[model samples]
Structure formats: structure tokens, C-alpha cells
Target: MLTAAAHLGACAGGDPGVGSTNPFESQGNSNSMSGTTQPGSDTDSTPTVGGSMTDSDTSTPTGPGPGSDSDPTGSDPTGGPTTAGTTTLPDPDCVDDDGDLHGEGCNAGPDCDDTSFNSWQSCGTCVDQDGDGFWVGCDQYGPDEPGPDCDDANPDASDGSDCECAVTPDAKASDTCAEGMAGALGVIAEGGVVPPIKGSITGIDNGPGNGQEDWYWVEFPEAMAMGNRPNAGKIAATFAVNPGDPTSPDYRFEVYTACNKPAFEGLAATYGPGTPPAREWEFFDAHSPPNPNPNPNPNYLNNVPWPAKVFIRVIRVANDQSCSEYTLQVSRLPT
Candidate 1:
């Protein structure tokens, strides 16, 4: 009876396989056995599997598991709660201030002209606040179409019109001689009109009866001396008081060959009171003989060489306190 019982125990302890009864021999196996198990029984306690282990007492884990810190989802790798939802974006049309097909303000788009809905689309019709019939935004307009008014404030200064202020003439003494010589008043050309010069006599005189004097210069270019022979040797400058006052003090006119300032002592010729109201001062080379010719052919040519530059002085004789208006005429006598 003892032998039969021993044989029965041996049969009950079925053949021990090649390795232990751990069913999950390879790590690649999905179902692994880890908990305690009956020595020969086929059943195993809840498998503490290679992956996450499920607690028999509770459905969820009390604390974070192995890879809880590394996993971005913050849940057990095997099986745990997860989040699933959708994110809504901003509306496309709400922020588009300018409908120029471009958005403004943030990442929407680059639309500089946000004020007008489609100003960029129709740039030809830009704003014209002054209403001078010209658009103020763009400079590239047709010649006939006025645009880019220089002075938007003044309507009179619109496109195609003068935008700058008129320049006024200011004549001051020493204005000419400051450059080493008086400025050339004008050239001696036949039929040329010498503009009248107006200036004050106040404070210009050295004394009560010394008379006030003004200086001027004139140039005779070689071109003017080329043609007429008789006139080539004679350059005459005439002076007259416009609206001459009979009671007005006599005015003297003198011509000089040099431009020496302060003392125009060159004194090539002189004409004044006792002479006709309209006097013609002549200039000739210094080496030439005194002019023996009469009226129309007065002694005007200078002793200086051709293409000469002569200096002139106008003096208001003593007692002439009134401002004077004078007209000067320069001409090359006809042959």
C-alpha cells in the first residue's frame, strides 16, 4: 500500500518542463506571470506583469508609476485615464480692418492703409483733402492729372502754378564794390534800355553841401565793338532825370577808367550843371587825343583798350535834398 501511494504522488507532480513554470519566458510575450502560484497548479495569482501592475484592492493607482514622470500624458502606460478634446481658433474676418484683401494688426496680414476698406486696391482714388483736384498719396500721376501739391495748405500754390514767393530787389551801397569793384550796371548795346535806378540820398553825402554820390560800372564787350567803325571808337552813356523838376538841384555825372573805390580819382571825364539837361559822357583810350567831334559824335570813346569796363558816378549837387529818379541810357553810336 505504501508503494502505491508514493507512485500516486509522483504522477500528481507532472513532468517539470525545461524551465520553471513562469509562462512568460521571453520578455516579448504579452501575458507574463509574476505573482505567487501553486507549485504544480496551472493557475497563477494576478500576474504582476512586465508592464503596469493592476492593484487588486483599488481600480486606480495611489501614486505615480515607473514612467509617470517621463510620460507626457501623466497616466499609466498600460491602461489609465486620458484626455480628449478640440481647440477652437480665432475668426478670420473679425480682425481685418482694411478689406484690401489683407489683414491688419497681429499675425493676420500686412495692410498699411487700414483706414480705407480697399484704398490699396484702388490707389488711384487716394484722399484729396485740399480738393485741388489732385490726390495726396501717390506722386506718379499723368502730367495732366495734378497730384502731390507742394504746399497742400495753400490752394493758390497748387500743381502747375508757382509755389514759391516772388523775389524782391534790394539795392544797397557797397553792394557792388565789396567784390573789389562796383557791379556792371549794364552793357552798351544799340537800342538797349537801361532800367532806371532809384535810391535814397539820405546819409550818403559827406557834408551839407558836399552832395551825395552813387557809383556804377558798365562793360563794353568786344562783340559790341566789332561792327560799327565810327561807333567802335566811341561808346557814349546818356543820363536824364525822369519827370525832371525845374527846382531840383543839378546832378553831376562823371566817368572813370579805373575801378578804384573810396576815391574814384580816375576822372576820365565829367558833365553836369550848365550843360544840357540830358548829358552824354564819353570814354576813350588814355593815349587818344581829346575828342574834337560835335553832338551825335561826342567824345565818348575812352583812352582805355577795347572791350573796356568803365566806372560811373552820379552826384546830387549840394542843396538837393529830394530823392531823385534817373534814367541811364548806354549806346554805341552808329557809324
Candidate 2:
């Protein structure tokens, strides 16, 4: 399980799979909700570049442009038309009775229950933080998460369109082990961090099950020349959402030294699902940079910046590989 402290200091050293919140905490954000919000005049969540999320109060914008419930052309103080779709901006004196940065809708925001923090009218079904839909599960927030929208506490992110996030071309590739050298998405130098490499697995509907695999090549700096890079580099991967059955993971990936040899061999060969949350369904492995013998033999890579090369192959092992996306992160932390 990824820890909180590790994520807070992520940038100091790269932290990919290590998430921010505690997974062991309470679940069940499953209250059917409705609404939309902007960055907000109150609480704002800053997603760290290192790929961690942290929430805190910041300087309020004058107020949000309008809420999901806003009246596009409605009454304001002057009784003219308003900016929102009938949703009014909060009244100037609309002090938030609840600690949640959101104000009361009566004040022209979405907070119907001003007495409660982050409260919303009960759809009484599933908790949709963005008020997108009732599909996402309460405890789960991963792409595959059945739903709490990852951070259950947060009031923003994801308007809930299944597979709505654009699939970047960089994350796509032919599925095969090309001879012995598959074209990699990119390389990972010492102390480098690859945020999230998303890949889609939309298994064919008719027939012909997949015999496919992904290729990711990472060449770490040599041990002696690692500057401030840590001795070990880590690669972590997890599906965005378990589109089918969360308990039964339909996909898998493994680390390799080359096209044939296993990188984690005796340590850990494959990475896949674990607990319920996709974050918990992770495979995090570390490898030390290859150390070259001081006694120079016929080593052409002696002066090379990166000599420890590893191949990552994401494989479709499940018989029913649903149409879902996966995220892979590689981090060579400074620490």
C-alpha cells in the first residue's frame, strides 16, 4: 500500500504508485449527488506534478463563474439576469457554516445543506462527486473503481463519461515482441519520472481473443554515474478502471531485462490487481542500476550515461479482457 508521507514529498524524489490518501480509511462516498463546481473561491486541490494530489484552502476567486445548478439567465441582487443557468453566485455575506469550502445554494451556490461539510441532496444511490452519474462506486475511485471518484473528500474532477479522458497517441503501440527489440514508448533516465502512461484494452467483441502485449523501455543510469539518482528505479502499473469485474483482474504486465529475460525474475515477475481500489491493484518493483566492473574489459557501455536497460511488457492474460484503460508510471527517484 502506498503511504501518505511518501506522496507529500513526491517531488523531492519521484513517487508514482505511492498515492496520497490512506486506503484503509472509511469508504462509502456513495450518496447519489448532483452538481458541478469550478476551482472554487475556497478549497482547491492542486495535483502535484510528481503525480500526487493534495487539498488545501487558497485565495478565493471572486467566486465560481456559476455552478451546475446556476440559472443561466436569472435574478441577481439587481434582479437582472445572472451568469449561471439560474444558479446564483453566493451572497456576499454567505459565510460557509460548514468547513467545506462550498457555500450554500441559498447564497447562490450548490451547498443545499450549509450546516454540513460537502453535503448534497441524497440521490440515495451511488455517490458521484462530480455529480456526473450514479455509476461510480462509493469506496472505489479508480478508473476501474466501482466509484468514490478516487478522492472521496474532494468535490471536483471527472464529469463522468466512461472512457472520456482522451487517449494519447504516445500511449498506443503495436502489441507484439518485435523480434527482440520492440519499439518503446520512451526512455527513463536517472531521476526521471513518467507520470502516467495510459493504454487501452478494448478486446474484440466477436471473437479472436488477444495475444497482445505492451512494450516500454527504460534505461537507467549506471550505478557509479548515477549522480544523485537513487540506487534503485521503480516501475508501477495499474488499470484505470476494472471495467469488468474488479475482483477478477483481466490484465497483467511484467518487467523484463530484454525481450526474453525476466527483470524481477525471482523477486516479482508480474504486476496486477491486489485489493479493491486500483491504486491497491498495483505492481511496484525496484531495480538497482547495473554496476560495471572497475577493471575495464571490452565494455563499450562503460562511459554510457544509462547502462541498465529494462523492458516492460503489459500483457492481456484474462480471457475476457474488457474495454478498459491502464496507467503505468516509472520513477527514478532522487532519494
Which regions of candidate 1 are displaced past 4 Å? 1-183, 207-211, 226-233, 242-248, 261-279, 284-304
Q: Report the C-alpha lDDT of model 1 over 169-284, residue by residue, as the tens digit.
A: 23423322333443357676543444654443422234222435556677676566545323454456555452222322234344555544322233222322212111344433
TM-score of each: 0.33, 0.33
Lowest lDDT block of 10, candidate 1 = 4-13
The true-versus-predicted C-alpha distance at residue 146 of model 1, in Å, is 63
Q: Please write out the lDDT profile of model 2 over residues 139-201, one tens digit for every residue.
A: 122343234343232234343444343322433544544444444545555456666766754
Clashes of each: 11, 21
